[model samples]
Target: MRNLEQVLAHAENHCENNGSRLTIKRKQVLTGLLISDKALSAYELIDFCKGEFGETLQPMSMYRILDFLNNQDLVHKLNLANKYVACEYINCNHEHLVSQFLICVECQSVKEINISKTVMTELQRNVLQVGFHLVRPQLEMNCICDACITSQA
Candidate 1:
């Protein structure tokens, strides 16, 4: 994983290249996600901003920021947990592959993994065979994280 400064710089460059601006609040929100060890909901982000950056963010505003970040692919929304995490590939210059999330059901920790093109092709084929078009190729799988499992044991 890239350092926070490098990731943020990469995100800034990426946004500028896309003809969009990464505003201060957006940076703050992205920073919160990058620093967090787990995915965070908008409310948690609001709290993070208030506590960490001494900034007060309204829920609607926070959602908009999250939406912008998601659109930029600088962050990803984990639908299974209804939370968001910073994109792990922010510092990478290559195009992204199909991404899957391993979400810890017990602790809500998330890990992003890339699926091989061959596997993604097979999955898409299966989807098409069922007469359903695969819209978002991202997958979110629920599981227990190592820490959670060890605690249970």
Candidate 2:
């Protein structure tokens, strides 16, 4: 878990660097996502916002906030689960792009790994050889972690 105030401050810096404004609603939604270790669906986020902000927010408003956060690379949407999680690292300089994720099946924890330059180049070459163009390259793999395995035994 992260300090909510620190998360907000970091988010504010991110917005300033990107020349975007972190509106109150966006901050609320982002902070809620940050505090959660697991991914949350849109509806869950709406409920969190209502509980925190004391006002019912529309689905459209939530979607807009999500879209903005995604575009700015502040949050990631897991296609498999149809949920969202705040980026593990917030100060990344790279353009907002899809990322590969490793999910621990037992704990439901997620880790993002950057696509190495060599791997990306090789993938592009192989795809071109097959007369295919790659669009989104995020790969989600399920595996058991050491702690889970040990605890299970």
Candidate 3:
């Protein structure tokens, strides 16, 4: 679990680095995400914001916040689950990339892992050999985790 204060400070620094201001609403949305362990959908986030601010947030507002978070690399969209997970490396300086996620279909748990550099290089080489350029790779696979398998057994 991440320290909420640290996460907020990191978010502020990130905004500063990008010449942006971290607005109150954005901070609330980000704080909500940082405090939760599970990935949340936009609707879930909206509900969270409503409960936090004592006012309902429009879907458009939630989308705008999500878009900002995504662009800032503070959160990642899980295409398989149609949800968003806060990136674990909020303080890291490396540029984010589209990567593979190991998803447990039974328990709905997700783990994100980067593609090996060698594998990416090989893929690029193979695609070039085939007279094609790889733009974005969407790789999501369903599998069972150890805990899930043990629970089922």
Candidate 4:
């Protein structure tokens, strides 16, 4: 609960600074994401809102909210799994160097990682060599988690 409050507070401050309004509905969506252990799709978020808050959020509305959250740097969209996760480093805006997502192919679990600056520079340089610019340097890697691999074995 305390953690949620802190996240909420940070979000509020961020919204204020960025000239954006974090409405109650947006907060509700963010709360759902924060409480979930795994990345959640928009439909999953809608179900969660209905189940937990007794409110129904339409898919279109959810998409708008997700877009706002992503713009605010409060959420990340995992392309591999087509799900959203609240940014783990919510309080530190400066710490966002390059976010790497390690996704478990079997269970859709995601782990956020930061590679060293040297590595990030190298990656950017390589992309430039190929005539591509990285708007945001994020790498999504697909792998089976240890638990999944062990279970399979």
Candidate 5:
């Protein structure tokens, strides 16, 4: 994985290439997620901005910024947790189909992983068989992390 500075620079370049600017506030929000070890809700982001940068952000405004970041694929929203995390593939140059995450139930640690094309196809087929549309095509699995399990033992 690239360092924070490297990732941020890549994101800036990506946005510019796509004709969208990564504004200061959006950058700040992305920075907050990058520095965090787990997903964060919008309210938590508001507090983070206020504490770290001494800048107050309204909830609605934060949501709008988050929406933009999500659309830009700079960050991803965890539907199950109602929180956001920076995309792990932000620095990658190749296109990827992001579809799943492993979330540590005990520690809230998040790890992004790609599923095989065959598996994705099967999952989509199953959803279609049930007469439900897979709109997001994302999955979040809950499990105990190694650290958490070791500590428990």
Candidate 6:
């Protein structure tokens, strides 16, 4: 529960304030992601739950749960890979600048990193100058991880 304690508590608090609740199924879906080695697509998560826990949840059900978690910032979606990863900064109460993702193309591993404030500021300025509002900007880069690179060599 090292990763889930803070997340579940924050979710409970947020739901309490919003008149919603984090159901058991939702929590289970989140737990799947928390223990995953790589970002998981909706179908992959469905398979994981069934294989790991003998529970079969419909794809639609998982999708809805994912959407809610995403809205709560408890998870992040990698558009390039069409997968989701649990947010690494959920325990931090303080605000974060920009979040960047480094995804291993070969093994599908994902690492979330925060962009420097200076760079984020300049990037925001550029976007604003172009008259496009950047909402929750996430940069995803595709690369081979060290393990994969080493294994290849």
The numbered model that scores best in TM-score is: 1
How does each model score on lDDT? 0.94, 0.81, 0.80, 0.89, 0.90, 0.86
Q: Which candidate is the best by lDDT?
A: 1
- Which residue pairs in model 4 clash with each other? none
Location of the lowest summed lDDT over 10 successive residues in candidate 4: 88-97
Q: What is the lDDT of residue 39 in candidate 6?
A: 96
lDDT of 4: 0.89
Candidate 2 lDDT over 30-128, as tens digits, reads 988888877788899999988888857899989999999987778888887778888877755556444678777787667777777778788889999
Worst 10 residues of 5 by lDDT: 96-105
lDDT tens digits, residue span 14-102, model 4: 99999999998899999999988778999999998899889888999999999999999899999878899988788776857678988
Please provide, for model 5 over 38-68, each residue's C-alpha lDDT reduced to its tens digit, 9 standing for 90 to 100.
Answer: 9999999999999999889999999999999
User: Rank by TM-score, descending?
Assistant: 1, 5, 4, 6, 3, 2
Model 6, residue 93: C-alpha shift (Å): 1.7
> How do the candidates rank by lDDT, highest first?
1, 5, 4, 6, 2, 3
Model 5 TM-score is: 0.94
| Residue-wise C-alpha lDDT for candidate 3, range 1-153, written one tens digit per residue | 677888888888998899987888888888877887567888988889888887587899988988898878787788878888777778667776557778788876677788887887888899899899886664677888889899989
What is the Å distance of residue 42 in model 6 from its true position? 0.2
* Overall local distance difference test of candidate 3: 0.80
Where in model 3 is the C-alpha error above 4 Å?
94-98, 128-132
Per-residue alpha-carbon lDDT of model 1 for 2-82, expressed as tens digits? 688888998999999999999999999999999998999999999999999999999999999999999999999999899
* Candidate 6 residue spans exceeding 4 A from truth: 1-10, 17-19
- Provide the RMSD of all predictions against the true structure, rounded to 1 decimal: 1.0, 2.6, 2.3, 1.6, 1.2, 2.0
Q: Write the per-residue lDDT of candidate 6 for residues 1-153, one digit (tens) a residue.
A: 355677778766766666777787777778888888899999999998899788899988889999998887778999999999988887676776678999999999999999998999999999999999998789999989999999999
